[model samples]
Target: MIQHSLDALARFSAPDDDQLKALHNSIISLSTEGCGPRECRALLNVFERFPDHDGDGLFSSIVHLLEPCTGYETMLIKSVGPASVPFNALMSDRLLNSGVTEVGGQSLMALLAAAKAHH
Candidate 1:
């Protein structure tokens, strides 16, 4: 299921408005279908790496969809890995200030603290 979505995304070199909308719909569908932690991580990686052809609004939308997924905080931090400092900074800022759900926010904070301790 995840691979199908990823493949659909990969096929678009330069998606038009309709294509983008379709992608958005697909993402919404994926959320409804339920994504596992590994699948969510893969999706996050792809979304984070997506070229900012639309000022990153698409990426942000995609991230929002996965925000409620299980193990999202752990997958989000793991998705950061050791690259893309700018993306990491953006995520950090979002995590710090965004109006995420209370449980989500607490989970992210706990993961961040654990990561900090390990590093």
Candidate 2:
């Protein structure tokens, strides 16, 4: 799914709705639960390339996901409002700055604040 998202970004092919939904869930997990740096780095790089990708409704999915965030996604979204920045950029920044390694043990509010500082 990650590779598909990255490939979709690279080849200018819009991912299917299923892929977009998976991407949304994957991003939500990445933001809220944390993952290895290698994984985070790969996902972040992939996401960084997506702001210009069209046809997949990526941005709209992001907005929709963030609008009704189920968990930590809500805290993060509220930091800057769901519309404050492009979702790809915001997620990449959050991955890099949010000290995600500490995610499950810490309040997302602080992590989001860290992300907000950089955004």
Candidate 3:
């Protein structure tokens, strides 16, 4: 879960160091403690810059905190409810597995699509 969170965090641009790390911890805490989606959303929302994300800034973030990857199965995208696990979380794992770049053409939409599929 830590690795997943770290991978998700990588998609974000902290410019300054440690900001993403702090966000990662907050998200994990929210998810593991079973905090409401509002809490989870707040934590994730803080790190993302939103529509300003070079297009439709997509997925990423923490769910299992700093411990091992035990609770990933229980995590989900905040607004989408627990049913839709963050595509970023899945993408982070895909990225580690070299699944991202192998996705598609040079188009941004294609890339996002691939990330979604692979994840």
- On TM-score, the leading prediction is 1
Which ranking of candidates, highest lDDT first?
1, 2, 3
lDDT of 2 by residue, 1-119 (tens): 54544443344334667666666666655445444433334443443445455436555544443433335343433433333345543553565465543333555455556656765
Clashing pairs in 2: none
CA lDDT scores, all candidates in order: 0.59, 0.46, 0.39
The CA lDDT at 10 in model 2 is: 41
Candidate 1, poorest ten consecutive residues by summed lDDT: 80-89
Tell me each candidate's TM-score: 0.57, 0.32, 0.30
Candidate 2 vs candidate 3, TM-score winner: 2
- Structure candidate 3, residue pairs in collision: 1-69, 28-65, 60-88
Please give the RMSD of candidate 1 to the true structure: 5.8
Q: Summarize candidate 1's per-residue lDDT along 73-116 as a digit string, tens digits.
A: 65566554334334443565576687542343345555445545
- Evaluated against the true structure, the overall lDDT of model 1 is 0.59
Q: Give the winner by lDDT.
A: 1
Any residue pairs clashing in model 1, and if so which?
none
Better of 1 and 2 by TM-score: 1
